[model samples]
Target: MLHAFLAAAIPNPGPEAPPGLGDLTNTILAWIKWGCLVSGVAGLMICGGMMILGRRNRNQLAIEGVSSTVWVFGGLALVATAAGLVSVVV
Candidate 1:
Protein backbone atom coordinates (compact mmCIF):
# COMPACT_ATOMS: atom_id res chain seq x y z
CA MET A 1 0.00 0.00 0.00
CA LEU A 2 1.04 3.63 -0.54
CA HIS A 3 0.89 4.33 3.22
CA ALA A 4 3.15 1.40 4.03
CA PHE A 5 5.65 2.40 1.31
CA LEU A 6 5.87 6.00 2.53
CA ALA A 7 6.35 4.96 6.12
CA ALA A 8 9.10 2.54 5.20
CA ALA A 9 10.91 5.13 3.06
CA ILE A 10 11.15 7.68 5.86
CA PRO A 11 14.35 7.22 7.78
CA ASN A 12 14.21 7.33 11.58
CA PRO A 13 16.32 9.90 13.42
CA GLY A 14 17.30 8.51 16.74
CA PRO A 15 20.04 10.19 18.87
CA GLU A 16 21.95 11.59 15.91
CA ALA A 17 20.46 15.07 15.96
CA PRO A 18 21.56 17.66 18.55
CA PRO A 19 19.47 17.74 21.70
CA GLY A 20 19.21 21.52 21.79
CA LEU A 21 21.07 24.79 21.15
CA GLY A 22 24.24 23.82 22.95
CA ASP A 23 25.88 22.22 19.96
CA LEU A 24 24.96 25.16 17.71
CA THR A 25 26.22 27.70 20.21
CA ASN A 26 29.52 25.90 20.67
CA THR A 27 30.05 25.59 16.93
CA ILE A 28 29.36 29.29 16.39
CA LEU A 29 31.67 30.26 19.23
CA ALA A 30 34.48 28.17 17.80
CA TRP A 31 34.09 29.86 14.41
CA ILE A 32 34.14 33.29 16.00
CA LYS A 33 37.28 32.45 17.95
CA TRP A 34 39.16 31.30 14.88
CA GLY A 35 38.01 34.28 12.81
CA CYS A 36 39.06 36.74 15.48
CA LEU A 37 42.43 35.06 15.93
CA VAL A 38 43.30 35.13 12.27
CA SER A 39 42.18 38.71 11.76
CA GLY A 40 43.97 39.86 14.89
CA VAL A 41 47.23 38.34 13.77
CA ALA A 42 46.93 39.87 10.32
CA GLY A 43 46.09 43.29 11.73
CA LEU A 44 49.02 43.20 14.11
CA MET A 45 51.44 42.25 11.37
CA ILE A 46 50.27 45.02 9.07
CA CYS A 47 50.37 47.64 11.78
CA GLY A 48 53.80 46.52 12.95
CA GLY A 49 55.13 46.80 9.44
CA MET A 50 53.68 50.26 9.09
CA MET A 51 55.18 51.29 12.37
CA ILE A 52 58.60 50.08 11.35
CA LEU A 53 58.39 51.87 8.03
CA GLY A 54 57.24 55.09 9.65
CA ARG A 55 60.05 54.95 12.14
CA ARG A 56 62.59 54.46 9.40
CA ASN A 57 61.24 57.47 7.54
CA ARG A 58 61.24 59.59 10.74
CA ASN A 59 57.65 60.69 10.15
CA GLN A 60 54.47 61.09 12.25
CA LEU A 61 52.95 58.03 10.67
CA ALA A 62 54.45 55.96 13.46
CA ILE A 63 52.01 57.48 15.95
CA GLU A 64 49.06 56.63 13.75
CA GLY A 65 50.38 53.10 13.38
CA VAL A 66 50.68 52.73 17.14
CA SER A 67 47.11 53.93 17.64
CA SER A 68 45.87 51.51 15.00
CA THR A 69 47.68 48.65 16.69
CA VAL A 70 46.13 49.58 20.04
CA TRP A 71 42.68 49.60 18.48
CA VAL A 72 43.26 46.16 16.96
CA PHE A 73 44.33 44.75 20.33
CA GLY A 74 41.34 46.33 22.07
CA GLY A 75 38.97 44.87 19.53
CA LEU A 76 40.55 41.46 19.94
CA ALA A 77 40.17 41.66 23.69
CA LEU A 78 36.53 42.59 23.38
CA VAL A 79 35.87 39.66 21.07
CA ALA A 80 37.58 37.28 23.46
CA THR A 81 35.53 38.56 26.37
CA ALA A 82 32.32 38.26 24.38
CA ALA A 83 33.11 34.69 23.43
CA GLY A 84 33.83 33.81 27.03
CA LEU A 85 30.57 35.38 28.12
CA VAL A 86 28.65 33.38 25.53
CA SER A 87 30.21 30.15 26.73
CA VAL A 88 29.35 30.94 30.31
CA VAL A 89 25.79 32.01 29.56
CA VAL A 90 24.97 29.35 27.00
Candidate 2:
Protein backbone atom coordinates (compact mmCIF):
# COMPACT_ATOMS: atom_id res chain seq x y z
CA MET A 1 0.00 0.00 0.00
CA LEU A 2 2.70 2.47 1.02
CA HIS A 3 4.80 1.49 -1.92
CA ALA A 4 1.87 2.26 -4.25
CA PHE A 5 1.44 5.75 -2.81
CA LEU A 6 5.09 6.55 -3.22
CA ALA A 7 4.98 5.24 -6.73
CA ALA A 8 1.90 7.30 -7.66
CA ALA A 9 2.90 10.62 -6.11
CA ILE A 10 6.00 12.43 -7.14
CA PRO A 11 8.22 12.63 -4.11
CA ASN A 12 8.76 16.20 -2.98
CA PRO A 13 10.84 16.29 0.14
CA GLY A 14 10.42 20.05 0.20
CA PRO A 15 11.28 22.33 3.05
CA GLU A 16 10.41 20.82 6.38
CA ALA A 17 8.06 22.77 8.59
CA PRO A 18 9.72 24.79 11.32
CA PRO A 19 9.65 23.24 14.77
CA GLY A 20 7.58 24.74 17.55
CA LEU A 21 5.85 23.80 20.82
CA GLY A 22 2.44 23.91 19.23
CA ASP A 23 1.34 20.42 20.30
CA LEU A 24 2.23 17.47 22.43
CA THR A 25 3.28 15.42 19.43
CA ASN A 26 5.60 18.12 18.16
CA THR A 27 7.16 18.63 21.59
CA ILE A 28 7.59 14.90 22.08
CA LEU A 29 9.02 14.51 18.61
CA ALA A 30 11.60 17.17 19.29
CA TRP A 31 12.51 15.59 22.58
CA ILE A 32 12.84 12.18 20.97
CA LYS A 33 14.96 13.49 18.13
CA TRP A 34 17.41 15.19 20.44
CA GLY A 35 17.40 12.46 23.04
CA CYS A 36 18.08 9.75 20.50
CA LEU A 37 20.91 11.69 18.96
CA VAL A 38 22.58 12.43 22.29
CA SER A 39 22.15 8.92 23.62
CA GLY A 40 23.40 7.37 20.39
CA VAL A 41 26.57 9.43 20.60
CA ALA A 42 27.04 8.64 24.27
CA GLY A 43 26.47 4.96 23.57
CA LEU A 44 29.25 4.97 21.02
CA MET A 45 31.71 6.50 23.46
CA ILE A 46 30.74 4.18 26.30
CA CYS A 47 30.88 1.09 24.15
CA GLY A 48 34.18 2.08 22.59
CA GLY A 49 35.78 2.71 25.93
CA MET A 50 34.34 -0.44 27.47
CA MET A 51 37.28 -2.48 26.20
CA ILE A 52 39.64 -0.52 28.39
CA LEU A 53 37.28 0.53 31.16
CA GLY A 54 35.70 -2.88 31.62
CA ARG A 55 39.07 -4.32 32.63
CA ARG A 56 39.04 -2.15 35.74
CA ASN A 57 35.38 -2.66 36.46
CA ARG A 58 32.73 -5.28 35.65
CA ASN A 59 32.39 -5.91 31.92
CA GLN A 60 28.80 -6.98 32.29
CA LEU A 61 27.88 -3.80 34.13
CA ALA A 62 29.27 -1.55 31.45
CA ILE A 63 27.62 -3.58 28.71
CA GLU A 64 24.32 -3.46 30.57
CA GLY A 65 24.56 0.31 30.86
CA VAL A 66 25.20 0.64 27.15
CA SER A 67 22.34 -1.68 26.35
CA SER A 68 20.02 0.36 28.52
CA THR A 69 21.07 3.52 26.75
CA VAL A 70 20.36 1.91 23.40
CA TRP A 71 16.90 0.83 24.55
CA VAL A 72 16.07 4.29 25.85
CA PHE A 73 17.25 5.92 22.67
CA GLY A 74 15.32 3.39 20.63
CA GLY A 75 12.13 4.02 22.59
CA LEU A 76 12.45 7.75 22.09
CA ALA A 77 12.94 7.19 18.39
CA LEU A 78 9.82 5.03 18.30
CA VAL A 79 7.80 7.77 19.96
CA ALA A 80 8.94 10.27 17.38
CA THR A 81 8.13 7.91 14.55
CA ALA A 82 4.69 7.13 15.94
CA ALA A 83 3.89 10.81 16.33
CA GLY A 84 4.97 11.50 12.79
CA LEU A 85 2.78 8.68 11.55
CA VAL A 86 -0.23 10.07 13.37
CA SER A 87 0.34 13.51 11.98
CA VAL A 88 0.52 12.14 8.49
CA VAL A 89 -2.60 10.06 8.89
CA VAL A 90 -4.59 12.95 10.30
Candidate 3:
Protein backbone atom coordinates (compact mmCIF):
# COMPACT_ATOMS: atom_id res chain seq x y z
CA MET A 1 0.00 0.00 0.00
CA LEU A 2 2.80 2.45 0.84
CA HIS A 3 4.55 1.73 -2.42
CA ALA A 4 1.32 2.30 -4.34
CA PHE A 5 0.78 5.65 -2.59
CA LEU A 6 4.34 6.76 -3.26
CA ALA A 7 4.11 5.85 -6.90
CA ALA A 8 0.87 7.76 -7.28
CA ALA A 9 2.32 10.83 -5.58
CA ILE A 10 5.37 11.11 -7.79
CA PRO A 11 4.33 10.83 -11.38
CA ASN A 12 6.91 9.90 -14.00
CA PRO A 13 8.04 12.80 -16.16
CA GLY A 14 7.70 11.53 -19.69
CA PRO A 15 7.18 13.16 -23.09
CA GLU A 16 3.44 12.57 -22.89
CA ALA A 17 3.13 14.57 -19.67
CA PRO A 18 1.84 18.08 -20.24
CA PRO A 19 3.87 21.06 -19.08
CA GLY A 20 4.26 21.08 -15.32
CA LEU A 21 4.80 23.70 -12.64
CA GLY A 22 8.51 23.51 -13.27
CA ASP A 23 7.93 25.08 -16.69
CA LEU A 24 6.32 28.15 -15.14
CA THR A 25 9.06 28.38 -12.57
CA ASN A 26 11.72 28.28 -15.26
CA THR A 27 9.98 31.06 -17.21
CA ILE A 28 9.85 33.30 -14.16
CA LEU A 29 13.48 32.59 -13.34
CA ALA A 30 14.51 33.53 -16.85
CA TRP A 31 12.76 36.89 -16.57
CA ILE A 32 14.40 37.52 -13.21
CA LYS A 33 17.79 36.68 -14.74
CA TRP A 34 17.35 39.33 -17.45
CA GLY A 35 16.14 41.91 -14.95
CA CYS A 36 19.15 41.34 -12.74
CA LEU A 37 21.54 41.74 -15.64
CA VAL A 38 19.97 45.03 -16.76
CA SER A 39 19.90 46.45 -13.24
CA GLY A 40 23.53 45.52 -12.66
CA VAL A 41 24.63 47.30 -15.80
CA ALA A 42 22.64 50.39 -14.88
CA GLY A 43 24.14 50.41 -11.41
CA LEU A 44 27.65 50.23 -12.80
CA MET A 45 26.98 53.20 -15.06
CA ILE A 46 25.56 55.29 -12.23
CA CYS A 47 28.43 54.41 -9.91
CA GLY A 48 30.98 55.24 -12.57
CA GLY A 49 29.42 58.67 -12.95
CA MET A 50 29.55 59.20 -9.21
CA MET A 51 33.18 58.22 -9.07
CA ILE A 52 34.02 60.65 -11.83
CA LEU A 53 32.14 63.48 -10.16
CA GLY A 54 33.79 62.80 -6.84
CA ARG A 55 37.25 63.10 -8.35
CA ARG A 56 37.03 66.91 -8.21
CA ASN A 57 35.89 66.99 -4.57
CA ARG A 58 37.37 66.03 -1.19
CA ASN A 59 34.58 63.57 -0.36
CA GLN A 60 34.43 59.77 -0.19
CA LEU A 61 31.91 59.45 -2.97
CA ALA A 62 34.37 57.46 -5.05
CA ILE A 63 34.66 54.85 -2.31
CA GLU A 64 30.89 54.62 -2.08
CA GLY A 65 30.69 54.19 -5.84
CA VAL A 66 33.21 51.36 -5.80
CA SER A 67 31.38 49.58 -2.98
CA SER A 68 28.04 49.87 -4.75
CA THR A 69 29.58 48.58 -7.95
CA VAL A 70 30.91 45.54 -6.12
CA TRP A 71 27.50 44.86 -4.58
CA VAL A 72 25.73 45.11 -7.94
CA PHE A 73 28.20 42.72 -9.57
CA GLY A 74 27.83 40.30 -6.68
CA GLY A 75 24.07 40.35 -7.07
CA LEU A 76 24.42 39.66 -10.79
CA ALA A 77 26.70 36.72 -10.08
CA LEU A 78 24.24 35.29 -7.58
CA VAL A 79 21.38 35.58 -10.03
CA ALA A 80 23.46 33.94 -12.74
CA THR A 81 24.35 31.02 -10.47
CA ALA A 82 20.83 30.46 -9.13
CA ALA A 83 20.21 27.53 -11.51
CA GLY A 84 23.34 25.69 -10.41
CA LEU A 85 22.55 26.43 -6.77
CA VAL A 86 19.04 25.05 -7.14
CA SER A 87 20.34 21.94 -8.83
CA VAL A 88 22.80 21.37 -6.01
CA VAL A 89 20.14 21.75 -3.34
CA VAL A 90 17.51 19.67 -5.08
TM-score of each candidate structure, all chains considered together? 0.63, 0.37, 0.69
Preferred candidate (lDDT higher): 1 or 3: 1
Looking at model 2, which ten-residue stretch has the lowest summed lDDT? Answer: 13-22
> Candidate 2: which stretches are off by over 4 Å?
1-32, 69-73, 85-90
Clashes of each: 0, 0, 0
Measured with C-alpha atoms, the lDDT of residue 22 in candidate 3 is: 74
What TM-score does structure 2 among the candidates reach? 0.37
lDDT of 2 by residue, 1-90 (tens): 998998789776644555763576677777867877777677766665764466565887667666666675776567558757766875
Number of the predicted model whose lDDT against the real structure is largest: 1
User: Using TM-score as the measure, which candidate wins?
Assistant: 3
Candidates sorted by lDDT, descending order?
1, 3, 2
Model 3 worst lDDT window (10 residues): 12-21
